[model samples]
Target: YSGSFLYAIIDWSFGQKCNRHRIRTWNAEQRLICDLLDNYQVRWGRPVRNTSEGVEVRFGLQLIHISDLDEKNQVLITNQWQIYEWEDEALKWNPAHYDNLKDIRLPIKRIWQPDVTLYNYADTRLEEKRDVLAIVYHNGTVLWKPMSIFKSTCQIDIRRFPYDRQNCSMKFGTWTYDQSKVDLKFYRDIEKFDLNSYVKSNEWSIIGNRASRFTEKYDCCPEVYVDLKFFISLERRGGFYNYILILPCVLLSCLTCILFWLPPESPSKLVLGMNIFTSFFVLLLLLYKNMPSNAEHIPRIGAYYCLNMGMIATSTFLCTIVVHIYFRGSGPMPVVFRKVFLEWLATLFFMVPHTNTPEHHESYSLIPPNKAVCGGDKFEKFELLKERFKSLGDKHLRTTNNDPNDENIELTIEHECGQSIEDPLS
Candidate 1:
């Protein structure tokens, strides 16, 4: 039985070996192709010609993801498309089965690639380099896709803030070569830069994109340098700040109006006014902390904070004056003050007068004589003493009429007896 089993295994092994012959190992084929092209000299520029036409390096960018937009550092993290394609005569292949070999992945060092760099980069660290996938055709056309992460500088304008929109650009150009050696151009005729492939960001929304190419000429060299510019329009997601920062500030600002409704005589009115003012000051500090420290342009929200703080300060000052006036019992009410603040302004603001009650009316009638009724000069000493005595007698009569206690009635009888005796003696 063991001998028969060994014979059957040998037959199956031989049959499977014949079937394995038909299968091709792509890894071994790729190694063979690499060895063939290892000795090829890859030229980094155009074929030498007397004409001005230079090597046209086609460039394009496909935004994949937005890692971050650091407003504080003025930097941005973007995973983007970096496609560099220029005709390479040394890198061409003719696979026996052309239809089966669509593309190949090879170490980028084996072929020539442009030394393109972001001119506005904020970080000095080199981007991570890896093997690039290349598509080889019957002709010598080689399409290369290199992995890249762009950390570029962007000037952020946060004046509008929450509702602000930013137009940032990533500029690509050859590091050392000018237009005479190599020129850059967009990949193809792209009507609108598509963003459907990009990962959506929670903090910002991509609105639109545009691609443009321009050349810069310097006075020192007649050679023109070409740059391919990619413009990305971004609008801030305002829902967060609208509810967290703006709405609270607006509500606190509106609360200052309620101070007017509080009775001026209550100590709580002053306490509440102070508390509101303190809150306004704290909100202003928070606004300053969140804003960039640029003196050239102030944000509109900052202006609103300033205005609100000014209003709060003004209200506080007026509240102090109102409390003083409400409790002031020693000094005479100035005639001008009585006419303006007590009559016209009070009525206009719907503030009910305290002098309407019977007790208050009696006290109001005892107001000190106006200086205008004294012939526009200081009163004579004799007349001043006479007016003082008359005021004292009026106050005594009002007190006796309001109180009917036994002490007040006895005092009144004693005053009558003394007056009768003094009258006969005089």
Candidate 2:
């Protein structure tokens, strides 16, 4: 009787396997795969075994598209690869008798999926519900593939600006389950996050990527939550900024240097300087509008602009001083002033003196009657006059035998009109 009972148990197991095969073949013939969905209870609360060893939900990502990278809102959109551990009791069968079937397609609503969410999501719409492709094996392992659009928050640091690189991340895990029940694992060996596979972006380029998994322990809950994070490194495509913003600003900066070469007496010098300064101020305002208001750490480009504006302001101040000095007293230039500015600074800066009118030149002509000096060559004539003044000063000292500070000796080189002598060459 015991032998009979053992044989009966073996026969019953074999009969069950045969029945399962028959049912699978019938479903495939009738185009009734949906009926197989009714065979098991898929809406279980937990898909993992109740033990110390938590469920390992393998996760990965493949970038399909980059819809937008909103700087103002600080958000980005991409296709995320969704995966999880599913209960095998709901869907499992032998492949040999079911026409060697290894996979099946089912409406995603028919299976139980983890309630995962992007904690940094910026959109109001919920994740889409779509069909899932399931690959089953003899060992009762199910691989489910479901694709969805993820609009996640990305903290942008534009301090480096046009030449800046950015690192953005996407975090995924069960919203409710603790690490003790369900854990996330990065399938780094089997999956790859390829930058080349992504749709090219106009404003940014993919540089590199990384993946990691960890658990966060909350103060309120004793159970820690598992997290899977993926990082994508990107570099800004700076061609736009180079041509539109930076190029114009740089050209304006170069134009400012021209002001230093302009003649101090010309009204156009001041007008041109003022116009360049105004343009710089406008560019500064435009930069501020596009950048964050945080004033703690200024960008390198911003510092460049500030320095440019400062130089222009310094030039304006120096121009004012030049105008005042040019229109000052009509008397001859002081010996010390002429020696330091006209002889030293003017030569160092390659500044040429403006030529005086014929009437003014005739009054102080130092050249011989037979030699005709080049017109408007005031710098050369000024040197000759400087030497003549020194000689006259010495002769006066020997004749008067008076102190060098005596007003009469100092005023010895008076004009024919009895006025103080003026440096006509300047």
Candidate 3:
């Protein structure tokens, strides 16, 4: 039953108004509400005349904002609006009866709505119908739009890391009903989603997206289940990482180039190499700590760090060897070693001879005033590098030993100019 005396007054006033909006007085709206709910045939369960002909629920989603995507937990949390539209002939009415009332909003609880849910939900809260309004049109059509925060499980592949792209899917299907009871499909009339309403995410960007309808039969149940899957291709926003992570890693890796330029015997070479290696280790540790522990594939940035760390370790080891050999007392340089390394390699590297003080020139010099040391020299006297060392041993020993004319000298000592002969390590 509708309202009494007040309904009569409102019904009379509604007939006097010609305005489209004013046509629906309190009486008109209340009469429609009473006619729809007061019917004993209307029930709360499924609003359909026959169970054999299933009601098709045209459902879609509008992504408003990306709240967060947790890599470790492999969950994608999104803020979205759910859209559903279906026909219920049981709720249809004539617009002429209610002063051309085409549409009316009623409590969503008073109607039958699909129990669509994310099958792989990650949140603790269960999916439930919200207390809102569903628009009921005179043509036996209903439209329900509700905002929801969905935490759906998504597989996260971090193999590419900062440059990686991820494909995350949100699977929506009926929680209990089978395809025979409730069929799901995309709405062709409405724009799939509002692109203008989407807020730009700080860490991820949508590159590609697809919506699909999947129908499958479970092993335990004879009936097939229908679902709509929305796959979103998200590319990580690398601008922040480019500066904070990639740039620093590249700069630290470039520091390894300095090791080759340093002197072979200098201790700083090994020290610098070790320092760069330590930096790489620290970076790797930080990346590992932040990443999912169960990740199967290694990240590109991690591999890059490992490659440089290996180089630094190898170079540091070689540097240690070179410094060790430089300080070792290996008697005199071998004839072949001296010819290849001291003369050929040194000249090829643009190495210049170490200048000696005027006092020590006499000790190492052989045919000093005018000498041809190599093939293209114009000096008149030709003397090889070996002759200079022989002369230093035979000539300087006698001079330093204070023997002017020692004919039967049994020993010879060789040394560089101005260096102390007493300390061997120095």
Candidate 4:
């Protein structure tokens, strides 16, 4: 018990001494912050200990969101944060001298950053995050993150169209410096995209991604240059196209098929065909608006619409010919037409040749134009039928004594085809 009491007293004394030391360090840190601005150098140059060896800037990208992808212009817009880390000997300091201050946030202009820029940029403005701050650690390790929106060029292939997937590449490299002066490395040795903070797009989704780094020597310079290429595969969200475009296209195709089933002699059949054709043309125009006109391969959907349109046009022309043949009494029916349409097609369609015979027909005016359409010899039969109708009307007036209300004396026309036209006045 005596030994334990003595140990407790020693521990209390050490704790009080440590508390006083911490208070002294706190004052030192506050005093150091007052001189932080004065020590910061805005015009600092690139820090390299050996002039021959380059300062290696390890960098990576954190993709936040894909705003839009324009197929016509072949441009992709994205929002991302650029992560860069490198050691600067000129920016180093002793942390113990300033109360173990580990890091400080300073305007990026006070230090040197790698001139890494998007190589495949479509938009000219690449350096948009200039006024950002970098976190400077006491050991001279600087960590900088600058957020920027990039518009990069991508080769667009829309042969699959609404269901298509695209692969876009973003290449980052130092613009003016060679590999010897400004070597690039992946931040933290990680190669893939940092999509931990990704916001998904409504029209497209990221399916896959690839990252690679390589150095190349070009003809313009003898020295080699380093670049990091990141590729993202995007797949279209087809639900919108299916409902807005594909569904309507399919329904129009079905209607085009039905146009052939409409009666050949009906004028409305041609009108309906024209309507379908117009609707299909409108859909084609809408599709062209979204796709590039200079595509190499024709899309499957485009070919389908074109073929359907041709079918619609053919149906319209056939309907017009059939209508004209039914009304034209002078032109003799062609033998091929009589054999194919009147005989073969009629049998195939389950139609009887003289199905409109007067025995089954009601009125004298129920003219089966099919016979006249078949041969002009039936004109005399029609003329005789008209004379008989003229005589029947006069005979009916004499029998009824002009009494329309007399039900006993019914007015009727007895045609040569053995059919009667009964009057409603009876």
Candidate 5:
């Protein structure tokens, strides 16, 4: 055999003590046999393929080799495909027909990556397929299958499946098929750890049963999925607090605004204004007490109420000013003060952007007459009485003229032409 290489199909078996490789070739071919016996060593306690009664399952391949059984570098298979091949026959390849053979590579399956999210709980490994939560197996392997389940648990009671009913229906059954199922009897000794329930122990109680089911034939993994209800409660925390605080504040502020409708003529309007101011102050105090003091900005509810009170207070102050100027003097108020108090204030309230309150009204009162306007008429009446008094005095001094009608008398009390008395008419 010149320029020929001989290749043999090697079946390396260990249980029956066999050695078939020759150490020396006459043509000086030295095959290196570096402890070849160790490669096929078999332990007495190791499981072997055999056939018996109850031991048949125990002896026959309970676990298939995931790939080529290289314990140091293990690989898992997910898709079915060819994994072995022999060399193809061609005219130039006759001398080394069996020397090189082609090995088929299959798609790897069930490869797990360590999930850091579950590090605080029991050790967990996740296997994902097509971006879905396929399996979260316990972090170990016995023989070839994952040893996710203990040997004691039975009757798994899943509180919630990984998928909702709609998705579950689309996928499989009442329970979502995305998660792996393991034997229930293998989980009796273990307890599941919940991160949220554990941290919030004072608020929530720990719940749900932790069990196992057959993911494939012998693999079992943890199934973790929470419903939408759990997440919704977490998202509404701020909204709930805001609603509780703002509802009452809005109602009271509206009531305070209504005080502006009280008639300016009524005595009660002043009391109502004072009362509203007190109530506003009290509410402001309450807000400070209940809310966090570190917030430099005001709460939304407080801002709204403050704005309402401001408009109402401005309206009340203007009414009081109008009443004061009306009664303070006998005539109309000075034009400057009237313009400042009426026109400008009216613009501030009625013409401003926030003048949309439903029941606000403009108030005006009339000024009283001045005493100087009627002074001359009062003086003329006084002068007529004085003339009667003087005539009575002269009656005692001289004989009175017996004339009931003195129209013919030429006598008159006359002063010099240039002289004048203060005319009563004036």
Candidate 6:
């Protein structure tokens, strides 16, 4: 009968497992796989805990496990406190014991992460008694899932919220002060129990909801309406801001171009060149100071440095041309040569047309015209002399014709070279 009773008990336990539909439900099967303490014993003990006074205390629970039984009648016991509850009547219970009461699997059913806020002990005058923070879990329903569970302005009561504050004081924490009656510093923990991470996720959410959502209600029906909004913007890449630094580099690069216009022979060209080089170095140092050292590739600003160097190189070339011409010393140039050279240089520089013509050549002669033979007065005098000579010859012929009253025949000297005798008196 005892054996039969034992068999019946086993059958009942199996039946209870089947009723839960372990085979039909995948979740049940998964839960069954981890159900090592189905009838386990619970143990109570004290773990080291820190108090507000910075002192450590021993407090814990002890448990004995009873559920790990197999068909072979092998029973295993575990000391882990799988199922334990606090009895407030046991005055030994500290407020910190509430941390161990979390539902490890409750996160799956929550629409949003669970959060806790505590009631102000000072205001309620229940400093250590009723200052319990209530846990809020967003209910994921068909209608609520589509909406933001934690929005810019969602309902949250400070009376039961838990916050984690680490290095940042600007965020909300469990130890914040409501110094200003009008406003209070809100604290929030990134995770449930971590004290190192703080978040300011709710402040702007409250302000944003006031502007909109005149009549929107949340699950808890909180007194204050808060709409959810993301206060801080996401971090953006700074490649464009890095690109902005190029402007100064370009301006400095342009300064090197001034060296080109400086008179080649003047001392200013070398001085300007050195100054430009110095500026390039200075800019390089500034860029280095602003940027991280040990970089492999050059930044966009470095390209400006390279470009300025190119300008300096071009200036150096121009200086070389100036020096070459100055040292050649071709002596004082003739007017014609100077004109031609200037015209060629201008044509080369300005691309003008050459206008020198042959008549304008320097080697052409300069002389006055010989017009004596072609003069009008000289020809008239010569004709008169000829007429006088002919008249004298005729008078000589008349005297020889024997006119006694006529002047005596004064033969000057008749020298006959080749003249005929008949032509003497006719």
Best by TM-score: 4
lDDT values, one for every candidate: 0.61, 0.60, 0.69, 0.70, 0.28, 0.29
**lDDT top scorer:** 4
Over 4 Å off in model 4, which ranges?
1-44, 334-426
Candidate with better lDDT, 4 vs 6 = 4
Model 1 agreement with the true structure over 212-282: per-residue lDDT tens digits: 88899868777889888888888988898887678977787667667655534346657876787777677
Model 4 per-residue lDDT tens digits across residues 117-228: 8989998976477557788888889899898999999988888889999999999999888888888999988787899999999999999987999999889999999999
Q: Against the hidden true structure, what lDDT does model 1 obtain? A: 0.61
Q: Candidate 5 residues 156-186, lDDT tens each?
A: 1111211101010000011322222111111
Candidate 2 residue 142 Cα shift, in angstroms, is: 3.6
* Candidate 1 to truth, TM: 0.69
How far is each candidate from the true structure, as Cα RMSD in Å? 14.6, 12.5, 10.4, 14.0, 25.7, 33.7
Ordered list by TM-score, greatest first? 4, 3, 1, 2, 5, 6
Lowest summed lDDT window (length 10), candidate 1:
417-426
Score candidate 2 by TM-score against the native.
0.67
Clashes of each: 0, 0, 0, 0, 12, 45
Off by over 4 Å in 5: 1-233, 236-247, 337-426
Tens digit of per-residue lDDT, candidate 3, span 1-426: 456677567545533424445435557877786667545244456777776888899998889899898888888988888888999876799999988998888766556778888887898895434655889999989998888888988888998898889888888899888998899988763424445579999999999877888998888899999988888889998898787678889789667666655544457767888888888898898788757889888898999999999977876666566555445542454576556655665566554444333234353354442231211122221233334445556554645554432211111112121011111122
Q: In candidate 3, list every pair of residues with a backbone clash.
A: none
lDDT of 1 at 191: 25
Would you give me the overall lDDT of model 2?
0.60
Q: Give the runs in model 6 whose Cα sits over 4 Å from its true position.
A: 1-254, 331-350, 353-426
